[model samples]
Target: MPRRVFVHIGAPKTGSTYVQNVLFDNAERLEKAGILIPATFAAHDQAMTDLREVPWRDPEAYWTWDLLAEKAAAFRGDVILTSEGFGAASAEQAKRAVESLQPAEVHVVVAARDLWRTFPSMWQQSIRARGTWRFEDFLAAVEKGEFEGFWEHYTANRMFLRWGDLVPPAQRHLVTVPPPGVSHDLLWQRFAGVFGIPDGLCEMTEPTANPSLGAPEIELLRRVNAALGDRYPHRMPYQRVVQQHLVKAVLQKRANNVRFGVGLDRADWVMALAEEQINQLRAYDCHIVGDLDELRPAVMTDSHSPGELADRQLLDAAVETIVGMIGHADELRQMIPPGHSGVLARVRRGIRRRLG
Candidate 1:
């Protein structure tokens, strides 16, 4: 049989990072078991230049789709294209993605979570991307249908149709995140089943999840985004610092155990909306793994709101976050090799010679 392909088109924050972590951690073993993670998730971004409707100065991007295809085609076994972003592609873009990986039976796997729970996390993600919207405003944007990406990602009813538009219902699989308190690794097991991987196969790579921020921690980051407005016009520098360093290295460490969730007022609407979405998900003819009812989130009460937090809460978070940045900066500087320090290298050398 031709190589089979399993693509985890994400509705992000639904264990996408964990899934990729497991697959990548056990890449060699998975490959030996006749499965190929064709490329890193970021590498696939190059393959979507056309789908993004963006211009590419890098010639390599022009052929990245083909190159991804070539890697898949050369592999003798199944291929896995894992990216949460893939879950956001429009129907036409998804069709293009499907076409590029032709001559193989391509299956799509979507991991979905409770809609009400996803929003706060999604807002945290937006803040990481330099959004200055307060928590309440973010929710307003979603309800008003103003937040395009949020609508596309959080609505399983909409994304399923778009991603499964061309693929058959049977091959379009849904993995519902089991509600809290169940086996944590159950999500991976559900995913492994859909991807045709044996459970506990190849030592079953360590379970991992992305770092998350508490409400106050995320609020602090949102304010920081507002303060840094227009400073780094380029995406890379900001992404390198705020996203890669500040968020990951600093803010994430400042998280209090206090979980963030929708307020009672927002919960009323979000729960209602999640119910509507769940009903719509029932309408899809796709195969379902795990309980679909798990998508219905209970109204959350014990939660912190970014807008409603006390000044003290935010001040405490900010102070620690600042300290974390300093410590992290020092830690990073320690990791740098001595000779790699440019002109500082000459200064240190002269000091050492005088001491000698």
Candidate 2:
């Protein structure tokens, strides 16, 4: 039976991808040390989706948590399962998660970020997930209970409310994301500590970071999303077409000087939320890997917001993005295999076959 389990429930954009990448990069080394990180657990993270009972494109997501728990029950070593999805698991979902990982000592780790920082990234993330809300409106909605589900991910207090009963105070960990411009190595070190990974076991080497958009680019995409509502209604097509193709190929290549931020007026509220979270978490006395003050957002003094973008700037960016998409189409017209079943197409076919 597994002796230990560490579940890294992420509040997104806190360098979770980089952590997962490092795990895969040194899987063998980690396994030899009596720590088992299954490739499925690290790469797909479908288990969280299963636990939360959320909809996703993966056919295998339905039973992924049970499958991993089964694997964990059979293993003799410690296991680490990570997913940002778990950060938003409801109380019932969290109970189910605890029950499934039976007999093993389960620990919860939430690498949470400041709302000021995480909210913007999450707005862009919502757009990437085919949401059509403007940044301002998204902020307003999330501030209220209207989109509390999204808000729950970044709030450790709410997360703890759901999962705190499942584990002892010592087993619950709050790994605060270091402030902007701090070395990510520090973040990795914190994660390694919570995972019981020893320092210098593997060459930290270079890091893999997911490319993210600036405020203007994200605003442009938001406008584009509103204009093209429901054309790619499902997750996979929207992901392949907008998220993968247009955003990665076109927008990410452009030089974006605008930074996303909360206004100076809003900074006080952001800090208050941080204070509330820190106070709530302190009562739990959870093992903290980094300073809780780091969760207090540093208000930007010279931010260039998406709303401040000029009409000409947006027009030029849109034109350039269209040109890039055209070039990608040309490349596909030249290079794609005749019977190429793209991933979404294959999934659609599979779903139809299942229905048939």
State how far residue 20 of model 1 sits from its true place (Å): 0.9
Q: Give the TM-score of candidate 2.
A: 0.88
> Which is the leading candidate under lDDT?
2
Whole-model Cα lDDT of every candidate shown, in order: 0.76, 0.78
Summarize candidate 2's per-residue lDDT along 226-272 as a digit string, tens digits. 88955987666787788788888788877766676666766767677
Question: Which whole-number lDDT from 0 to 100 does residue 158 have in model 1?
Answer: 69
Steric clash pairs (candidate 2): none
Q: Where does model 1 exceed 4 Å of error? A: 48-50, 54-63, 233-235, 336-356
- Summed backbone clashes in each candidate are 0, 0
Candidate with best TM-score: 2
Q: Please provide, for model 1 over 69-167, each residue's C-alpha lDDT reduced to its tens digit, 9 standing for 90 to 100.
A: 778888888988776767777788888878877779888888889977788888888777677888888777778978877778665666777878678
- Shift of residue 215 alpha carbon in model 2, Å: 2.8
